[model samples]
Target chain A: MLCLIAWVVFGILGLFSVKYRVLAKESFDCVFRRITFKKCNSNLDERIKSKLTGNLMKFSPKMARGVYRHYEFLSWIFVALFVVSLVLGAQGAYNLAMYDNCAGPNADPDQCIFTPDYDVVDCDDPLCDDGHCEECGDDCDCEECS
Target chain B: MMNVEKIRKDFPIFEKKKFIYFDNACMPLRPKVVIDKINEYYTEYPACAGRSYHDFGTRLTDEVANARDLVKKFIGAKKAKEIIFTKNATESINLVANSFKFNSVLTSDREHNSNLLPWQKFDHDVVKSKKDFSFDLESFSDKVKNFDIVSMVHTSNLEGYSLPVKEIIKIAHEQGAKVLLDGAQSVPHKEINVRKLDVDFLAFSGHKMLGPNGVGVLYGKEELLDGMKPFILGGETVSDSTYDSYKLEELPHKFEAGLQNYPGILGLGSAAKYLMKIGRNNIEKHENMLKSKIDIEGVEKIGHVGESGIFNFNIPGKGAHEVAMMLSASKNIMIRSGAHCMHSWFNSRNLEGSARASFYLYNTLEEIDTFVEELEKIKKL
Candidate 1:
């Protein structure tokens, strides 16, 4: 607690220092601030963009042809990852939302809904094993002998 | 042009399924006349080609030789003796490659494997292709002097690229070299003047040009064929035989050494007649017109290798095998996928290879519309 208080006091004193005041003035001033940030924006990576373009330009027609190809490659990777994540997240959320009600006696508001007859999906083709789908073993494996 | 609807009737596949078969690079489904010829040979007088004493066999032999004459005329050869029969274009090429005495050979990666592989793995000194998959006339000419044979495909199977055959032939002759062309893709779709091209040899398949399977043609300069020894030796190829020594048959027969499929020969002969009647110039225009519109954008990552009516494109996420299964099941459209027995070339290009849709003469515009629609649907998936 004391260390936190001390640190806050030191920060306050630093803010009031001569060098600090000039810095604040410089940042708040619109024109100078604009010049500094636009030239050195941390969020927008101008260097990486330039580097990418340079590499892209150096490529001969053949090399330029190759790869994911042009900017479409980057887009494809992004799209693939985005699609995979969205699907996985949706599946996870759905599983969580239905977990308890999936086998609960009071199916209302349960995480998962249970069928009394357990005949919803037929898994009898080896995957279901002897016509059972809902009755799982001690290891939580499904048995399809119904 | 030429009342395509009326022409399409001659090819029975259009009657069965209204499809535009742009995949002629793969193979052409036989026409009714060719198919009927095959059926007649089988039912009426099915006999081995080239040799016989009986009436049916002699008729069959005469028909087979007549087929050779038809092919020679079709390609504008000096003599029918220049033509050699084989199973297909692939075997015809293999025969030439195996027999041709070469210190070195020059071709390009632009070639289908039939033309390229003959020399790439050949125990010869030098086998060279273009740095990229494009053709270079100057490079080819400069190198021709050093190489013994300059074997190249007349038009690339991938791009439908037509090479400067006449110029290349002249260059090869100047260098005292021989040239062979793979016309398997070009012959069925385009008109070729082999005499004008002056190439030493040409090979093409029957199946790709609206004929039956188990039939192909290899056209060599008469002198060259007479000098070179035959590859396969069996019962029919021999002129006379003794226990110790046997003299081989001359010209086309020397190259063909077995009991031939006379049905297949007559079918191919009819196919040649079909081309002659249709006029190759009109067919080239019609097929190219379809090719010009095919949407190759779906496979832009691999891109269309060439828009020469053999549309080759590779999908990024889909391997050709999986894509082929999906296409077969989801859409009634059929396409040939995988490396096409050219794994080495595909591997060198850092690709698993591509799916191909090759087009031919009988294929209609409506079929292309269906193909494009299916391709668009496939892209969405």
Candidate 2:
């Protein structure tokens, strides 16, 4: 549980630092090794797992033997989730950098983006009586603005 | 008494997920409305409160003040001015310990570290809990007379054993000692009436009660707060200041120094509203119902499973941490293990720790049954 929590945190921090991204990738590698039943070289994952589940050994040797086998599956699942989160968070940050906001295409631009005048952003039609464009007016389809 | 399905729908964490959360003692899952409120702040009006006179600043100030009022009502405080917002319960307790005037302090063995370390600066005496996980009231009574302040945990996170605070407060008052209730566990799970308890100070964390992290409450009596010194000092806490002479602001404002957490406080206000709408009495009843029928084979209970949502136990021969880990890995179940920050209680009894599963309003009977089934599998392991 502690290991997964750390990975999730590091994954979030990976957004700001490449060093954290490296650490998260190493952690993910450890999880991947467990999934493939490879000879794991990373002692950090094993140490964390042992320290966390150490109480079980004292509680009952039998229970420890039974449940320890499943730790690998949990590690894999957590790493997978961390990867997804890191990818989506990066994508959002990328979108926000390129555009003023990272809102979904279907999202209302008024609520998602900041602007002094809504009229300028929404005015898609060249023809306008007042500053508001009639095509993108109250009954406008609103797709052309996006 | 609450509609479980309807209540669960309010929380987005449950959406598109079949996972069960029993970590309420650590941090409760936030509701969608609270998340929406947070997002709304950053998107629409991201401005500092009490620092500007513009439209955005005025709206932010009102939101912060409104949040303080909501917290005051939630804990049954005498006035809104009595509520001081801090980062968490640890900060709140530290604030009272550092600010209050006291020569000696009294606490108990079952206290979390937040309630313990803050008093170590003074001549502190600790009353131990009995072997059965109950507080030794006689020890408390004998020690109360020697201390000027009685700081205590309202409920033990280890066993969910609630201290007899009303009677304890009466005894402390008779001995001319002011009391501080560590309401971290009690405030979220039970209804807290500071006015009725008559405690001088009450501290609790918002995250443990379905609100955002990094936001908590330190509620003091209006008079006591006025008398106590400020914990943190900077821009927001001062009215007027010079090189050598400075004047602090009144009540809550004096304690809340620096830029405040406006979004988090708004989230907490929403959490308070959510809890109130469901009714605290109903939550208590539902949790009690869940605690009563908790069935497990060959597990040893650490403390009395009273009228609380907390359950602490160990597999007869299985280590508590092992059980917690195995359950999480195999079933995605989350339960707390270890000393639970009550090292004094566990070390005194020659025990390491017990596995703890805490429930909240969002928890269901189905989750408990699933937990027991997983426990059965761990027994085979």
Q: Candidates' DockQ values?
A: 0.01, 0.06
TM-score, model 2 to reference: 0.75
TM-score of each: 0.68, 0.75
CAPRI quality band, candidate 2? incorrect
lDDT of 1 at B262: 76
Q: After superposition, how far is residue B45 of candidate 2 from its true place, in Å?
A: 1.9
Q: In terms of TM-score, which candidate is strongest?
A: 2
What is the lDDT of every predicted structure here? 0.68, 0.81
Q: Write the residue-wise lDDT of candidate 2 on A72-142 in tens digits.
A: 77766876787788787786666566654555444555654531233443444555445545544564434
Tell me the spans in candidate 1 whose CA falls farther than 4 Å from its real position: A1-146, B18-20, B120-133, B295-298, B301-307
Clashes of 2: 5
Please give, for residues B160-263, the per-residue lDDT of candidate 1 as tens digits: 66777888889889999888888987888788878888888899999888899889999888988888887788877789999999998878788887777678
For all predictions in the order shown, the interface RMSD in Å is: 16.4, 7.9
- lDDT of residue B164 for candidate 2: 93
lDDT of 2 by residue, B177-198 (tens): 9999999998888888999999
Per-residue lDDT of B27 in model 1: 77
